[model samples]
Target: MREEYEIYEQSLPWILEAGEIIKKRIQEHTEIKRKSSHSDVVTEVDREIESFLVSKISEHFPEHNIVGEENVGNRVSSSPYLWIIDPIDGTSNFINRKKDFAISVAFCERDRGIFGIIYDVMAGKLYRAHTGSGAFLNDVELNAAGTDGSLENELMAINAPWGSMEEMKRWEHFFKLGTQVRGVRNYGATTMELSDLATGVLGGYVQYYVNSWDYAAGRVILEELGYKFSDLNGDAIDRVYCGGILAASESLHQQIVQSLKESSKEIK
Candidate 1:
């Protein structure tokens, strides 16, 4: 516990400093470029903030390995300590909405996460959590997830195959979950979506595929509050990456999982 706090305190400043850089850079003209596809994008600010944070980890925790979305620095295949980072979790949001983006970081010792931090830069809302400690948004502690363990009338966030989600008849699993909930919302940003789950504002969240940096921090924060995270098939997930994710309360997660498993390829 003491060690977790120590690491958390040390991490706060480094991440906040990176947030400041993003706030400043967001106001200026940004250079945007495409990645795997036209919809997959990265910005100059993303690279800059990631490089800045990588340097901090290198200086403060020299032996730690870093795996950032931007691929900023010296990366390794494995290390005792690893820092997963998404300097700008919502790069497209930063470019479009400007206020919906966040900076996400998670520190892990081997396979266990020590702490996680997600800073909603424009809103000045910093969500953080350490193992055994409670989750927080800014200074206020957040409530546990699945308070009622019921999904009735609760908002759901779905992130899956873009095309599958767009075309109603595509992926029956995603489409079915949408009907089971009161309503559905997608921020196109995993950190924000996960924070909503951590805060209990969102009843549940699911994604067909995501990188390690996308949900590593959120997984730490949510798990502390009794929330559950697993691959769509309800299997344990590793920190590296996975096919998909289903996050919610234990019971609710299983219910959703069952729904996904039973749904046919195309809705009849």
Candidate 2:
């Protein structure tokens, strides 16, 4: 366990080092590619950054497992220490030079996330947390705030592509809650959206789909700072690839879940 923690400590410098590499490449002419969907994007920089991170990690900790967003088959090991990497969280924004992308890394043991780091390369912001240690933005610690559950006064972050029948049903419920809240925002980057929630920049974030690499680090950080994280139905979130993540302060999370339950009944 001590050795794992040391490895995690060693991993931080590599994460920041990779972030510098990404920052340098952000301005260069890079090839953009589509993956899974037009909505899902990737870039040559993403692959390069992932490769750089993997090489550094392997050099430092040869036996550890790695699950990188670009390439995963070669480095996966059955070892307890696993590193999850999203070379660029908002590849579209990165490819287009929008400056809202991030590098996300999480260290887990036997499927339990132990430490997480999300580095906003352009903004020079690093959001990180360990399992028992508290969450932090850069060097300062963070604490979750707000108690008024009035939907009209809350702020929300949601994705833009949920207009289908199934999605609309969910949105109607969220919209009802939105009417009660202050407003809704779309950040276009899931890691940043989750970090916004962790840092209290936004009250909550609701997305219909997200993979493990998307929220793995943010989940641990937010939960450490008195925030709540669960699926839309309010079930405890499994640490794998769970879609429909609903994250917010404890009070707001309950309200959002209750509102969704009521809306579910109405739709039925």
* Best prediction by lDDT: 1
Q: Write the per-residue lDDT of candidate 1 for residues 117-188, one digit (tens) a residue.
A: 999899899999998878899889988765456656778898757564357455657877788888898998
**Pairs clashing within candidate 2:** 151-180, 151-181, 152-180, 152-181
Clashes of each: 0, 4
Q: In candidate 1, which residue ranges exceed 4 Å CA deviation?
A: 164-170, 265-268
> For model 1, what is the alpha-carbon lDDT of residue 226?
90
Index of the highest-TM-score prediction: 1
User: Please, what are the lDDT tens digits per residue for candidate 2 over residues 52-127?
Assistant: 8888878877888888888833375667777788889988878665688899998888668788999998999999
Report lDDT per candidate.
0.85, 0.80
What CA root-mean-square deviation does each model show from the true structure?
2.1, 2.1
Alpha carbon lDDT at 194, candidate 1: 93
